[model samples]
Target: MAVSRGCLCCVKYLMFVFNLIFWLGGCGLFGVGVWLSFTQSQFSSLPLSFPSLSAANLLLVAGGVTMVTGFLGCLGALKEQRCLLMTFFVILLLLFLTEVTLILILSIYHKELDEKAKDDLIKGMKDYNKNTDLKNSWDNMQKIFKCCGVSNHTDWHNSTGTGQLPSSCCRPGTDPCHRWEEPCYEKAKNFLLSNITSVLVFGVCLGIVQILALAFSMLMYCQILRAEKYMD
Candidate 1:
């Protein structure tokens, strides 16, 4: 009933290496989360509807969970403990399910999500002159994207004035600040959709890794249990 020495050694080492990589990735994510939270603290003044705040918070939670799962996986493999291995397996299963569910939800709600995002951006725009933090965030976004407002330069008319636009909306060297013609929302959407393939690929690869980890943990767990019973 005992696991063969070669098989056990191979699985143990593979699990260790995989979890080590996972742990380091978690560390990188956590660092990025901290950096985002600090740099974008200005976004805090905006309503919870703003996506920037949510993104930072999501990264923080995801990073912490990843670090914990990686630690459990590594420890379970090294120690060859059934309890730890089972726990690792359960956590990986849950993560895999959550990822799959999220992908499905996003795919189904794409349009709704788009509308919600636009609405939130518009609401944020209404406070442009009143909230410095929100104004700065929007300025940075528009300037970097070379975009005007949510839909077009005219989208700012209600907030600013009939004829005026924020300086960020304009291309350089215009005496009257000719505003960029593109909309921020469309630019951002296109940017995301253009990169969607890479995102999906990463998610698929991560899911595969989770599956392998789940299988390895369960196989090792059973082997350990058998070994224990044999010893008894």
Candidate 2:
């Protein structure tokens, strides 16, 4: 009987630590993506602020809050008091819910933005061809679009994307395919529509991972206390 009770107590402390580790891990991964988005948009040479910039900042804020809350939960777990544990748990849960909601809403508008991005690219090339007059000499004619590193047969696929696409690229005769590429383009339109579905999947999986971790961390601490009690 004594051994069984000690084992149960140990398990609870371990659970507390586990919960914090998973929560931090998950948030850290998302944080890098969010930071990258901001840097890519604001610091890049062609960096023009887009409507999507708002969304990126929003994610950053939410992720930060969630991470902090998770950490607090971990601390509370160590204290092993019911009130501290419950408070941290509630705060962490609310933060998670907020993040999931934003991820859903932003996904909706992302599709339309992607289409616009594609057209902008095509129009930019056409305008540049018409605007620039490099003497039209045989030498100039030979390197026309290629003057700006654009080949007549420039392949967007596998090409390094440093091109700035004007909105006019979306006009008729311009190819927008270069802007939104591959499976990402196909899925971007429907990503928001599938937000609810993604939430259900990610939420359940992440929630379980977080819960189990905390449960284990706490279980460990509980054991520590129990063993100490026994020695006493």
Q: For model 2, what is the alpha-carbon lDDT of residue 142?
A: 21
Q: Name the runs in model 2 displaced over 4 angstroms.
A: 1-8, 30-34, 41-52, 106-207, 211-232
Query: In order, what is each prediction's RMSD in angstroms?
Result: 3.3, 11.3
Q: Evaluated with lDDT, which candidate comes out highest? A: 1
Please give, for residues 1-232, the per-residue lDDT of candidate 2 as tens digits.
Answer: 5875657556555655566665575585467547646443321221122233343455466557657666766676666655566666566666656766766765787666555654443344343434433112211212221222122224222132435432222233546523222232233223323433543475566667666654554455455566667778
How does each model score on TM-score?
A: 0.81, 0.44
lDDT of each: 0.74, 0.47
Where is the poorest 10-residue window by lDDT in model 1?
Answer: 42-51
* TM-score of model number 2: 0.44
For candidate 1, lDDT tens digit of each residue in 110-183?
Answer: 68876787787777778898888888878877777799988877778865665778888989898878788889
